[model samples]
Target: MTAITVSRAAQIRFSPGQWLTAGLIVAFLGLFLIVPTGTVIYTAFVERGTGTLTLVNFADFFRSELFVRSFWNSVYVSAMSVVWGTVFALPLAVLTTRFDFRGAMVVQTLGFIPLIMPPFVGAVAMQLLFGRNGTVNLLLNDMFGFRIPFMDGLNGVIFVQSLHYFPFILINLSASLRNIDQSMEEAAQNLGSSGFRLMRRIVLPLAMPGYLAGASLVFVKVFDDLATPLLLNVKDMLAPQAYLRITSIGIADPMGYVISVILIVVSITAMWLSAVAMRNKDYSTVQRGGGGMARRKLTTGQSIVAYGIVGLILLLVLSPHIGLFLLSIATVWSFSPLPDGFTFAHYGRVLEDSSVYIKNTLIYASLAGLIDVIIGSAIAYLVLRTKLVGRQWLDWAATAALAVPGVVLGIGYLRTFYGVTLPDGTPLATLWFMVVLALAIRRLPYALRSCYAALQQISPSLEEAAENLGATKVRTVRRIVLPLMIGGILAGFVTSFATAAVELSATLMLIQSNADAPIAYGLYVFMQSAAGRGPGAALGIIAVILVALCTFASHYVLERSRRLVEQSHGTRH
Candidate 1:
């Protein structure tokens, strides 16, 4: 008999498996994307009295000048903030990555401190530091006999947001800068190119992709942010306008939906344009193995100036959080460099009544984190590994959540689930399912990005070898692929947990009264009361500690896994 060897393709039929995967994907999309979006559209149209469709809501939104002003204001604020953020962050990234300097590690860590604070908390800290009666103003009045206009209008909002988000640009650009090959710069320098000229020609172009990505993210984040504007009293912003329409006015108002739709369109368009910019450029500057560290000793004056610049940036980024932390421990923080009185009363209050917020935040964050990692890993695998049709679109769709603001998504949920009834006639007004789904969807982009990046680093040959050895696709994926991806998945999980814990805008809208409230919401409420500030500060402190713990855990796990992988590689070598 002729030696008959069945092809691996014959062993694994692409037909059934592909169809099943596709079906599962379709079901997932329908449950998460289609149903929630459909709810928004359905509620926007359905008339209350007649139970018929109407366009009055949209019409009112268009006709309202206040709404129009808010839309324009949001655009202006986002544009201004992005410009300032880039200006501040790009140089910082260049200094940290290109020039050898003291305190670089401290500067980098300081830059990222703002990322841990809740949006409203940042705004509140800004208010405390710069408001008319704030510490700066009080000092100025004491010494200069006049008050400065610092915390009001569009300017304050832009300043706070830029301070908060510039790190995004810094981190992205620094990674890109570190990845640039020294050979190119060495060649340029040998060709009689001056330092400035070399940077302009050789470095900037390579870093443009990362710069653009950071800029795009900042724009989207600032554009959709509600807390800063609201706290700063910038009434003319898109997010607060949407909130006013949904909560202050009513969901029946079309103005909110209109603003939401506009915000979505703008954010999506920005993301698409950024993606295009990234696609056209070879961002492989940061790829593995080719580019190594290029550390150059700086002259005395240059080193001093670099250290000074880093210190200034660190101060700008960290002062607000420092102020907040102090305020959290104080009986009253007004006008003094030190608190009026130091007390642990705030911490005690938080500890005593912490059950509800703590439980809710942990439960929701844990659930969302777990679900996001599982679903996001599958999506990443499907998009990166398989040659499925529309995989590109699926990848895009999965990440599309990044463009949707928390406020807009919350409103979309409100609109979609307004009248959704349970099996009984009672209307399902409080849809925790939809809330959890929204959190998962909003966080999916990060999880997917982390997973996809990790997946890309892994060799596909391992999977192919397993299959050739008669391992089923599912078995191979479970035994081989997942083990390699544990680090990435854990990273995603921690990120999701951190974000879900601090998430404010969506939780504000979706959380039902008499139900559990997350720490962010509780902090907001506590901040408003006389005794509330103490508890609020306490909650904020707890949140910071929790986030720090999770981040450390993630780093530890990832590092251990990486060491194991490296040892295995060494043994094989």
Candidate 2:
């Protein structure tokens, strides 16, 4: 009897669905994470002649000044970006969320523009404006008889990255600030608390979670970025270091793997800290009753300052795409204030050769979007809705991808799947499936978070009611849960699609020699070739338009679907 009871208890603990979910999670980690990581480690350590593990890779990396300098350089750049991002983002968030001025809506929208633009595009744009022959440089030289040195190395990379990522901090902090109960601030103000003291004691502590979350994201992103550094010739960083080990040096060099491991460790630590910060606080300001938006009137001077700030931000964010658009349409690009002449030749050439790039990007992005929504929804359900063992670990693992740099993951994929062959004896060395998989995995964290946020808003009693009526778990999920969660799934899909479209570093390593490249990669190639900058600019312009169209379409579809659901529910009632 005792033995039977123990056996039953164990069986209950490891139920079928739980086991199945666990298996799937493990399989995903194995294929995408473990196998690739293990491969890198294995290749890094294995002795060529004796086929025995060694530690030469670590030794070599530690001894190399280039590697050490790049590692510290990466840390310095990322830290600086975070500091600047926070300094600018905090005030903007507080002002926009706490006190409203004229054109507040416009300010909020403009602040988020950088979120959609690719980091590489931002880097390129900065180069065009601040480079030796750039507009700013030309102006400075004409006025002061000297040019500014802002486009060569660390300074350029940090500036562009910070500009591109500050929006993340702004949006996050804004949301956090908006979530603070008005009564808390009201009570403080009533007690004669004013100015910085009120913010220091009440507002900052309340909004710390959002600030930390945003900072963590920026740190991980800047750390993992490869394009900004690469474009600016700052290859002493981990991203470029890892890339060089694979392409410039041979895969036989273990230094890349060592950097990969270190990146993973640092990213995981950042993520862990962010998770700890977010655990006790709720950052959801879009709830049912959040006071219907806090509205505070701004003074005349404040309104002018707010509008000026918005205009400046818009100019900064839009300048790159504007320059790219002009270059794309110009017949000749010289050191003039504008293009030499406008023509449709570049667009025509792009259209003629657009099929391959367009098809590849659509296919890969679509597949990644679908896969992310499904996997993300399931993980969200498992963690937020179900009572599962080791749920927190699963949640953390799902999001851990956010902290990983695309370049590092790309290297891991190369190492893990390099020599392995598929079932029909076809070598997997040139398969672009790994590239798609990497994109999917890399973008999974955001998708999962979006879905989790949506799922948490739903009442558990709804699912319980369905189950009480004898509905099977699967049926209830399909009929009851999915309908409610479709909005989240679609949102995740849009976000994932956008990220995959612009992803560069991971694609750089995983893309096959013969396979079609996405627009970002294609632009990189075109810009580097002998054909000057016309073609690359044209392609960038097209890519930007496509992204805008897709996002607008997604918004329309989601809004229409939501309205239809509401109408149908009203009819039923």
Candidate 3:
């Protein structure tokens, strides 16, 4: 019997418990993500009222001059954002990883600061700082007698988005650079390859996979982004058009559904392009005696230049945080370099009246995070541990959510579930739980990756040992697998919570009232009005604080746990 059990486990045969877990996950994903998205796609290709299959909706989309222009504009903005993001990221990544730059850790840490604040929240603050009559231009006008159009029209959207998202590139590129075997660089150096020529030829191509990964992410993110372009008032973009069509025109409008289809297609196409670029190219270099690339010391001039560049990027990244803080307290900050006076009235008002946003965000994000980890863990376990038929399909399904835009998902939910009335006669889509579901589906891929990492680190032998001792599979998982994954589960939960707290695109559509709004939705509503900017800035600050605290706390706890484990091992030795 023991031999049979071990053999079955080795063969990856599905047990009753595994089957049950997978069934639950499949039902959840089908009910929430697949169904809604499918509804949007089906509606896009079908004739309205009659539900007859037709291509007229897509043809209408192509015929619309506004939509055609919006499509191109979205493409241009997304591509340019990737280009600018690469520019901001490349130097920092190279300087830290290639050379022994001082404060490399600090540079990397600070590089990630912009990610905590949603790009849309920074749009208003950026306008204040980089607008025509704003501080930077004003200073430039005074000093150089010329003002650069840093925040004009589409330029403003690209600038803020690039500054906010470049960290994605920085992180991936730096890791890639670090992983390049030192021997490869040494061999190139022996052939008299040095300096920029060597780096361009040898180093970059090796790290292209990582670069493409990050660039693809930046492209898709910028492409699907609704709030940033909306906050910037650049509505001649696909995402904003989709959003406006649904909310302004109505959810039944095929234009909105058509636009959502285009968004998903574009996202998939970009990812496919990235994959195609890296396909058939072997980048593996690490071998025996080859750990990572060797770091070289920078010269005095090089150090100064590197530091200056890093400092400038850091300042630009931190500008939103600084400007948000200033805007929140400023009595009146208009047509000037500084505020007329300072007051905490904005914060007070937010805390007093708009505290519901914060409360809702906490509830929604917490619930979303909970859902993600539970589902993510199950998928990860099924994929890694079981050789059950189609186990990998579950992972692929969950990860597919990454390509679906938030606005598209929102439209999907409205179209698919709004007609499904509850026992209370309320539209199913209007319920706050639907908002949580949208958030979870949107962030599920990230949480799934985290769970995969956690589960991968655990040994199958541990479970096998438990099972050999007559413990049931469920009991072993409950006693050993879950406890071991606590750290990763917590980490995944915090990540989902932090990101979901500021996710507005879907929430914006789902929010039936201000009472059900999350921080991101409330921030958007607040940023829309001139009078509401101050309160919006205050709310933005609170969101930044909330995400920062959660991220920092998770990092601190994980690090502390690692230290404790190391200490225990050291004492044992």
Candidate 4:
């Protein structure tokens, strides 16, 4: 029997339906992702029009002073954002995870609020509150006879990005802290280490994996960001330069392609370094009974200090949201600590004239979310439950989208698909459906991860039992596997939908008409003018509400599903 099993495993077998599903997935990814990205890379390396391979494009990139400066500027801004992010996140993560704090849950909950709004949307509000001649600076000058350059040049970019991206670190590090076995810390205390010294020597080292993961993510996201820097009018960064070059100089220019190649390299390198840093390091020491590291109780004086620290941080964290709300209602709000006047006219204006943006967002995000869950489910099943050859390659290909910047993907789509016209002779790249595809591709990795996690929690024996009872694979997946995985699939869809709704980088490159624009694009357009700031802020708030509702709905669905499953088990037992 063992010999027969081994021989059977060595051979490939699939039903017609399985073969069809696999073929369709491969074709979709190859046509939309691989071919377009390859075109961009190829354009960077080959001679224009002649198609002859050459190194001149890259040589020119390194030799140009502007491009070199832009490269270094991006590096500098990304590094500084990570540093500031650590300062903002480290204390919150430690206090909430390792100490007995009353408001820990609140801190954790509010910390994620920044992520709901895009950093660029917050960038304008940050300027109103933090910029020179803005609210804070005006107050400081009046009281202290001096002003600080919080939103001056690159400093502005770093400040806005750090505040927005720091939650990534906080969330990852908190989870890591909770997973640390208490035995290690107790062992360190046995050796007379009980304070900050113990944390530095033992706890932090164990949590290094989470720290690096979050920090590297922050770095990549900031580096790939296009709208924030452009909104701040800091155009010397790589992403903005790529957008400007491609849009202003047309697709024929090699500079944009070269910069895109460099962006891909940096993104890959950051993720690689994070992985290499954790290589061969076994920090997983959670024993069966080890819930987590024991928490320390704060003394009375310590409580006051901790609360004070949290209060100050919370104020900074909520500044953007507050400023945005005030700006939305204010008739005039320049150089004032508060809005000159408040009104609901902006919201009314948005509802009356900008309903198209909201409608389009609902349609596009829903379609993109639908596409993600389907592909994510298929890929997850193929990799986990099948013996198909090269099955793992599908997972890798889907995940590799994480390293491809949105702008790079947008550029790739433009170059690869612009020539293919519709029946009306319209360029395929200019169509609105291309926007949905770009969003789906950009967000696929996230959904795939969710599906992979969902499938991992199921026991293989259940599927084997169904098959032994003569159930077909299709029927089993539909009736058994998918129903069980619905919670994760819904979670993935919400994540993809929320993020895709606010995504502006790729859509900025692809949107060819106002009628096809989503909320993010409309927000960007409104934000560019002083007269439109109120309406733009109103739109931003609406986007936030939409995402918040979706998040709540997902949680409600998951809870309801859990109760239903428990009731079914009770009846069966």
Candidate 5:
């Protein structure tokens, strides 16, 4: 009878549970992500009026000097940003990881703080500090008798992007350095390699994979960014041009679709090349156990120089935050080293009039974050636990969202869902629910990564043990797996929520009214008016605080979970 049951089960293509889970994932990704992205690509190749395939869009893009320049401008900015960002990052990573310093943890923690704020949120404040008539230039004028255009046009785009994204390089390089087997370093040293020679010969090439990963990310991000260029008033770049062509010329414009396709292609290509370049290159080492690259304690002079360099970089990186905080309360802050006066009326007005933004952001970002972790948890389970065919493809498809620019996705969503309405008679695009959906789709990759990493850490025996105790798979997952994964799920939620709260491009396209705008849109609106700069700065501060609080909460949950895990292990042992 049992053999007959097994034979019948073998005949079935999938169990009921597997079918349900896979079906849900396919539907969710299909309805929100795959369909929209497909619509954009399809529209790009066809004529708007005739709906016939044509090469005119590609031809026109290359023929027009304006479009061609914008394309190259994106490439130039992304390339330069990666160069400058690596220059900032490599030394910082080396300093913190290769030497024992008292402030290493602080420096490491503070380095990543720049990523927590959206780029355009700091644009106005950066203009106040780095623009021709701004604070640094005024000081430079007083000292050197000349002003430099640090924040001028394309130059400013590279500067801001490099400063913000260098942390990616730093974090990746630091991890790669720590993970390196120490035997290679000692072998190189025994061969008369020392100082720069050691790093040049042994370390750099081995860490090349990490560097490539970070550099490709920097290029993709800067290439697709629309807000920084718009805030800096550099509209000749591809992303800004895409925005202008769509918003100004309307969504029917073929040039806009052409720009979107190009952006998506370039982004995916950069990431793919990075992955391919490192494949089969084997950087493994024979070092045993916990041995990593050796750390050397810095001499007093070296320590001082390291700290000084760190201090200088931190000052430059934090300028936007300090300037924004001051500007939020300043009555007037123009053409001077600092503000002339300050007040709290901006905050008061924000709380009084624009508070809906804060509330909606809380609702929209929270729901998006919750939805992302649920999806992430399911995907991670299917990929890691099951023998299901094409399960890893679920992970690949979700992570592919990283290569998709938010602006392109925004255009995709608009084109795909323009006329769709809910049962309540409200257009789907106009609902706050759409904002939540869009934010989830954009940030799904982040949450999925976190959940996948967490799931990988758990032993499959835990589930087997649960099953041995007469527990069903659903019961075991609900009672055992979810609890073990709470820390990572919490982390995924915070990252998704914090980043979504600051999403500009998708939010700008889908948001139906002022009543529905989030804090990011509020900041954008206030920054546009000269008189509204104070309120804008105030809104920017709130955003920074929101992100900081989310970060803190994530850390707290993770720490507590770690302690609990350690306790359980101790009890078991």
Candidate 6:
């Protein structure tokens, strides 16, 4: 917060190395984030054909019937998505946190599984199960001679998004519930509140901060999603329209920039709304000598009901993974309760035809993750350790990426880097290297948070001691601070890599050659063809495994880090 003045020791602690590092960070942020964002804002107000600054782009966008419809559709779908996200998350958070129940661990794990897979990856499989001519529809037709509009048009976007993103709500709510004081519950129960009524009136209201945080996050994510809407053949949404305008028409489309501006505005508004909602509320119910929320043991009837509810939710949540597996091996699955046949031929076919996508994903995502760490570590050090001017601005700028939709970023690159050609006369946007850069830009926020957190745990006295012992500032960081924070840095890298591997919206636009596409783009390509889904499912399975392995590895590293921290404290004691 407060700027540090240059004292004798402070001047000695700062070095040429920190100066150079801070300069590089500013340059990197400006080049990647500030430039593209500035370009978008500038171009949105400027007409391309006349090269004149005017508001006609906004006026024309307002006049277009399709654009108006798309604007409302995004608003309507994102609102519905947040509502469903709560529905899916609240009960599960309640059951797992407030009661002792069977399959509690399994339920939590299942709730998370949906999030590991991108909704677009499962859209095709969901179609096979809930599409008009798919298995579920066929079964319903035979049983009751009617079908539900579960996957119809924009409804499909809401359905897939609710399932995929509800984990945000569950995770945040679970934490809030855990930190709640037992005295509040006791007081409420003493006043004739019990069971669901107790939770609804007291517990839920108190957890509003976490609930609103997760809900706003879901709204922002759903509003910015491009792949899910495209997968469902619903292109009227703002994100898809932006992509279509940029790539399908031309890079000079001002309307695309206008859409990007709107997306950014909407995302920022959602986050602001969350903050505003929680601003004046006093949620502190903790006591100086507080106890805990006693977990109630379920009665036989309660146990059965809880298990039934959890099982049904798990089935619904896990349908994407199950559907993907079944579809991957199915020979012919149309209009049938089961596939006519099963085989590994799809996996074989994909491996034989195009395994390069998988390899490219690994290469691009890994490198992007590495780049994230480099910048994350630097920014963390500057913000936390050094007295660099406006260091907080670096952190703020990176976090701002969360609100910048991938599709918007993609279009921005096209606009900013237009006509920039490579050595081979190929455009810069088409290069695999640019995709890696974009991925790093998009994921740096995650890694930066992790690194900043890790550095916060280490005391500055340690670094000062190292400096007093004649260690240079660079050596102090390399030898003292980094060793302590390596575990968190590793976890951050894995998270960035896993997320980047599944990224589609940005990758789809940057990829000019089919040969250079990543696994997510491959998944999209496969789903486009009736015969290609089998192979797509096989690819989807591999992507899921990659992410799961990374998640487990991150957990392991973090656990090991905690142990190391405990051991260090023990030594100090």
Give the number of the best model, judged by TM-score: 4
Q: In angstroms, how far off is 176's CA in candidate 1?
A: 1.3
- Score residue 475 of candidate 3 by CA lDDT: 94
Q: All candidates: CA RMSD in angstroms?
A: 3.3, 3.5, 2.0, 1.3, 2.2, 2.5
Residue-level lDDT of model 6, residues 1-573, one tens digit each, is 233554645644656777788889889878777888888888999987787899999999999999999999999999999998888888899899888866777788879888778799778888888788777888899999999877899988898899889999998887788778899999899999998898789889877888898899999999999999998999999999999998778878889999999999999999998999888788886674235467899999988888888778778778889999999899988878778999999988888877898899899999999999999989999888777767788899888889888888888777777578878887776778888988999999989988989899889999999999999877988899999989869978998999999999888888888888989999999888888888999999988998899899888878988898889889999
Please, what is the TM-score per model?
A: 0.91, 0.90, 0.97, 0.98, 0.96, 0.95
User: Residues 157-180, candidate 3, lDDT per residue (tens digit)?
Assistant: 999999888888999999888889
Question: Candidates ranked by lDDT, best first?
Answer: 4, 3, 5, 6, 1, 2
Candidate lDDT scores, in order, read: 0.78, 0.77, 0.92, 0.93, 0.88, 0.87
> What is the Å distance of residue 102 in model 6 from its true position?
3.6
Clashes of 1: 2
Worst 10 residues of 1 by lDDT: 1-10
Model 1 segments more than 4 A misplaced: 1-12, 15-18, 38-62, 276-293, 335-337, 423-429
Clashes of each: 2, 1, 0, 0, 0, 0
* Model 5 lDDT per residue over 1-573, tens place: 999998777655566798789889989998889998888888889987999999888898999999999999999999999999898888778888777867788888888888888888777888999999999999999999999988998999988998888888888888887777888888888899999989988888888877998899999999999888998888889988888898888879989889999999999999989989988888776764327678899899998898898888888778888889999999999899899998999999988988999999999899999999999999999988886778888898888888778888888888888778778877666777878888999999999999999998889999999999999999999999999999889999999999999999888877778999999888888888889989989988988999899899899989999999999999999
Tens-digit per-residue lDDT, 1-573, candidate 4: 999998896667766776787889999899889998999999999887888999999999999999999999999999999999999999999999899999899999899899989899999999999999899999999999999999998999999999999999999998888888999999999999978899999999988888999999999999999999999999999999999999999999999999999999999999999999899988878595347889899999999999999889888988999889989999999878888899999999999999999999999999999999999999999899888878899999999999999999999999999999989999999999999999999999989999999999888898889999999877888889999999999999999999999999999999999999999999999999999999999999999999989988998998999899899989999
Instruction: Give the local distance difference test score of model 1.
Output: 0.78
Model 5, residue 383: distance off in Å is 0.9
The predicted structure with the larger TM-score, 1 or 6, is: 6
Number of the candidate with higher TM-score, 1 or 2 = 1
Q: Which stretches of candidate 5 lie over 4 Å from their true place?
A: 1-13, 288-290, 422-426
| TM-score winner between candidates 1 and 5 | 5
